[model samples]
Target: MEIRDAVPSDWPQIWPFLRDIVRAGETYTWARDETEESARAIWMAEALPNRTLVAVDGDTVLGTAKMGPNHRGPAAHIANASFMVAPQHSGKGVGRALGEYVLDQARADGFRAMQFNAVVETNTQAVKLWQSLGFEIVATLPEGFNHATKGYVGLHIMFRPL
Candidate 1:
């Protein structure tokens, strides 16, 4: 498998999985009914420093990630990122590879740290993954998310130095 910057031609492969994941409302904070245009606008890298990446085995896109500043101006030194692996590809190390690459990329971009502002607490896999990657739960907003099936759940703010 190869991990590299994503291009427009990759979107057709990415959208199907991305749409399914978002509509599941299991991990991401995006609207369950997120439109294709809106999702594309957010997932595709637009300018310097920000990036969208893909993990592919030949022509098959196994997963994707987006990384950039967690905030603007004074807080821009901190990076933020999101990841999604196709359900069929989960457990094959795609997410971990993406995480590691994003960390390296963020450091290369001069980021001091990385922060995840709203990690759904019930997503134990992600919680553990981030923790294993040296991130710590800085705070948890009690009952911050209204999960589709689990109802109210905490949203954890995770952080780690680049």
Candidate 2:
């Protein structure tokens, strides 16, 4: 498998999973009925100050990630990121590979740290993976997320120094 910068053309493959993930309302904060155009606009690759990557085995997209500053100007040293693995490809280490790549790239780009501002607490796999990667949950907003199945749950703000 290989990971590289995503091209607009790649969205044709990415949309299926991206739509499914967001609509499921299991992780990301995107609206459950988010339109394709709106989601694409947010996920599309940018020229600089941010980037998006896709993981593929040959021509099949396995997952994707986007990374950039957690905040602008004075707080730009802290990078922020989000990832989405194809549902069929989950548990195959796709997320780990993406996470590692983001960390390495952020450090190389001079980011002082990484922060995930709203990680859903009920997403235990993500919580565990970030922890194993040296991230700490610095804060948890009580009943911060409205999980579809779990009703309400905490949102964890995870951090790790680059």
Candidate 3:
């Protein structure tokens, strides 16, 4: 699969899986009823230094990722990113490729570090992936995430120097 910057045309393919993932309320912190318009606005970043990318095989979109500054102004040197893979593509290295790509992209963008502000602890697969990619759990807020099936769980703040 090839990873490339996403285009508006890709949204038609992206929204279905993105909607399913967000509505599942299992991992992401987004509102369970996230609207298509709002999601598009957020995911299709057009401003400078912010990017949205897709992993595809032929015409099929396997996964996506968005990356930008963790915060503005003085904190802008740190990068932040989010990822989503179609359920059908999970366990097939789609996420790993996106993670590696995002990390390299962040470094190339001159970020000093990468920080994930809210990672649901119950999402063990993701926790393992990030850890394997050299990110550390810098902090965990007690009962910070209300997982769909696991009730309240810790929310981790993961960090790694780029």
Give the best candidate by lDDT.
1
> 1 or 2: which has the higher lDDT?
1
Q: Please, what is the whole-model Cα lDDT of each candidate in the order they appear? A: 0.95, 0.95, 0.95
Error of 2 at 5 (Å): 0.4
Per-residue C-alpha lDDT of model 1 across residues 21-121, encoded as one tens digit per residue: 99998888999999999999999998778899999999999999999999999999999999999999999999999999999999999999999999999
lDDT string, candidate 3, 52-142, tens digits: 9999999999999999998999999999999999999999999999999999999998999999999999899999999999999999999
Ten-residue stretch with the least lDDT total in model 2: 40-49
Instruction: Report the error of model 3 at residue 47, Å.
Output: 2.1
Q: The CA-based lDDT of model 1 is what?
A: 0.95
Ranking by lDDT: 1, 3, 2
- Superposed by TM-score, candidate 1 places the C-alpha of residue 137 at a distance from the truth, in angstroms, of 0.3
Q: How accurate is candidate 3 locally (lDDT)?
A: 0.95
Q: TM-score for all predictions?
A: 0.98, 0.98, 0.98
Residue 94 in model 2: lDDT = 99
